[model samples]
Target: MHRSDSRGVFDALVVGRGAIGATAALGLSRCGLRVAVVAPAQPAPSPLDGPGTWDSRVFAMSPASRALLERLRVWDALDAARVAPVYDMRVYPSGREGAPELHFGAYEACVEALAWIVEGSNLSAALGRALSFAGVEDIDARVEAVDCTAPDHAALTLAGGHVLRSRLVVGADGARSPLRTMLGIAATERDYPQQAVVANFETGLPHRDCAWQWFGEHGILALLPLPGERASMVWSAPQELAGELLGHTPEALAERVAQASWHVLGGLRVLTAAQSFPLRLIRVDRTIATRAVLVGDAAHVVHPLSGQGMNLGFGDVAALLDVVARREPFRDLGDALLLRRYERARREAVAAMRLTTDGLQRLFGDHTGLPLPGLLQPLVGARELGWRFVAGSSWLKRRLMAHAVS
Candidate 1:
């Protein structure tokens, strides 16, 4: 029987049915919590996989993320052929020729691969199906308001006039999380002065299952491997450079990209419509507020150049699940103390990621200057040094990978 507390209408009600929210609902349900998910509508039918159906939205899922998905049983559900293993990664220094590159390989990390490049569509389809199997109730409506102070203190009022109650509310919403706002949670944000232009391309040269990144003069370009000589591109460029990129026609874009990449992949041919989004670092001082907690982009977002955004969200889910799993039977899920455990657990990891990504973005960014005080090095000098240190230190990389590979 459900507890008689107002939040006991259900153990948790997750607002925002994006990938993060859906994943949260699935994980909590699997943990034996009475879970309900609120979404704008039932998920649209997943498209049938076909030739020339490559999705532009791709993620380089870290090994840790893979474990979470595997544990959730969503990893194997995705069509295996659609995924590409990132056996190697090469990162070049910005605007430098002959600089030693920082490289990561499966062998170095003692893992099968550094990460897996997965299509957003493929993962979504799998997670959607998994949510149902996990027995999470689906509420098909938009969340217009969330009340954390009422008889059902954590009640969510839907746009359609339906009210759903829960002992705890989780905001898996994106960067602009309405649920976060409803709980009066504040966050620190900094624009990277960059925008990401993403798309799919058929490369003249095979990627060899390698993910490559070039820190060029005006932007950071990453070509993540896809099957059969295809790769996905994420160019995090300055505002004007991003505008220039978006203005180019497909053929022009390919030509420009190939030139920018120094013909690393021989040549490039656009295979899909391009997409762009501004980049920013969002950090919440506290992820928990009253009876509600935030996860995924709702809690924090870092620069995508590191390709750790999705992985970080998965980390958030994993951490939250761990806290929930170890809670005392007598402790209510929404207990302030129970919620603080979740906050403390995540604070350090989240802070390190923010500092790393934000620091790197600023370093390689068009901005001039060293982030350190009284450092008399030119921008070029610092960038080279950073790359060299990463390239030189196996122990450092392995330690980093331990946290990264999950």
Candidate 2:
């Protein structure tokens, strides 16, 4: 690894090496800026080949997210055999008999795919390669302190006692962002009484490039198609249910999943161990402070029911690039007004996604014992009504499909 020079100031310093952080470094560097990425070095991931070797965690990449990666010349580097395209999506309202089903298709939307299912590691590896090819400096160290009081620039002190200065610092450090804390930004956080269990499976029947989702009394179950006859599962269940599911043996768990999915894909053979993570909604009033900007999970996090968390992070990178690329020549990259423009452009989209996902989680959450307020009791039937509405209206479906692809 090459050590970053402490004497020279950078145009931007990215403080994370995840997909969003690495991509931000590459994008900013491409715009003729001296960029450096700060993070502890990590060992290379094992090759993702051979049968049953698949990542447990994957992301459903929207067309817009794909476009951003393509522009950065990173998408093509991904192993095509591991990527799966979603031609259609079928969503069934809570396991009620005779429940209306809502369907969205790439054909109806007049696009190649509704979205693509990609392994998180696959995306991260490609981004890493692109960053190296782009000549973005990699500071293999942890940030120990931040000083943004400097009028023209911010300084990041590494744990090794080296100080690196930059006009702007990007905090793509993630949900529990230390940089966000150091910058004195406050985030509103709410924890959902649920956890998402994820794993990959080899199905007895082909998924046919379709994504399946079911809302049940216990939780939400989604099966996303993977290459070949395999599929990835993300089951968002209440805390107690998640614990039970996680405790089951691999075979027992597969059987339980098969039963929950009503044997739609026939018998399921577990390809990977199940892992779970808590779900939550995180939002910050402002994404920028002085010479600092927060992107990705550092700025906001939403429920995974919509599978838009990663997409939203990628969207942040796109918006940040646009604002920085189009800024007035006289204004520096970290100019307060320039940063505000970036914030303004992202506010509405982020809020809408947060509201949509969080609202759906609350609406579909187990309400067996809990009583709905008299006036709000209508929601008990709203789920079915909303599904019927979306399913019956072609124009509405098309409108939604367009928004999703964008």
Candidate 3:
């Protein structure tokens, strides 16, 4: 990597080209500013070979995320046939046979839909086209160094010795962000004892555009609807259970999942390979520093059980864009005062999501053995009572139904 400064200064330089980073670049370009995306060279996308070949990675995008994508002109660009809308959600207490269920329906809440389940590939394709059409500069190179000491601009040294500078550097990179470390930002992380096993399955019964989740003793299980008679599964299982499941053949895994889901959608057939990833909660102390700011997983991470991790990241993108768009004419993009506005707007919401997911994990933690502990009984009873209260109240249901969708 030679150290020659080839690229000129830009209004903003975004690091990482994942969904959040791509969206950030697109959103900033709309401000009529020149933005450059610094990331590894992207391989050409291969054409789909057959019908219904879906990516294992999927996200249940909240309403807030959808609106932000729409603002960036990406929503309408996505393949509508492949997207699935969730009109209702059913959540059941774990480890209980006849526990009361908590339900949230968009119709009852007077909303169009609760959330949309989107395939990762569809999002990548949609965002990819938008980025090209938006005319954001793409510098395909590995980052050699990050220099933020400059008074006016933050600079990045590429492997080829090319230098890229910008008034503001946005880190929309995922967790383990090299940009976050390059900026000397530190994050606090806690490894959840659970690992998420995710896959797609073709269901015997139609999902009816509803999402189902069960809090079981082994872990939290969710079945998110997909287009047609298909559903995606996110089984946040204990480490031991995850290991066992990963060892099963596709047919065996299908049977296990069917039994666990109580055959609600009848027998299931695997549509994608089973994949597992460890769960964790991560929080960075500062989202913004001198001439630099962090967004998405680069800033915060939460347990996948709640399915709000990505939504929280999208919220960061929206907040930061709002701050930049509304900045006073005299203030630069990296103005400390302006970045603080974005950070402040995101703090409360991020903290709430972290606390909720962590609390739920602890509340339903494993207590199984030869004989159940006496204290565990009351805990279960209390959980049941709480469920009854929440399920019986229209206000609480509405309140929960609005979670992270704002």
Task: Note the Cα lDDT for every prediction shown.
Answer: 0.82, 0.87, 0.84
* Candidate 2 clash pair list: none
- Candidate 2 deviant stretches above 4 angstroms: 1-5, 366-382, 386-400
Q: Candidate 2 at residue 130, lDDT?
A: 91
Clashes of each: 2, 0, 6
**TM-scores of the models, in the order given:** 0.92, 0.94, 0.93
- Write model 2 residue lDDT over 191-251, tens digit each, in one string: 7778999989999999999999887687889999999999999999989999999999999
lDDT comparing candidate 1 with the true structure: 0.82
**Candidate No. with top TM-score:** 2
Please give, for residues 1-406, the per-residue lDDT of candidate 1 as tens digits: 2223243489898887877888889999988889988877765744746777788889999988999989988899998999999999888875688888778788978898999999988888888899888878887877787777864358778776667788899988789888787778888887777799998899999899998888757778998999889989999988888999899999999998888777889889998768898888787767998789999999998889878888888888898899899999888889888889988888888877776666666666546553532221233456667667667878756755665576
Q: Tens digit of lDDT per residue, candidate 3, span 46-138?
A: 554356687778898998899999988899999898899999889887657777788878887676788899988889899989999999988
- Candidate 3 lDDT for residue 104: 78
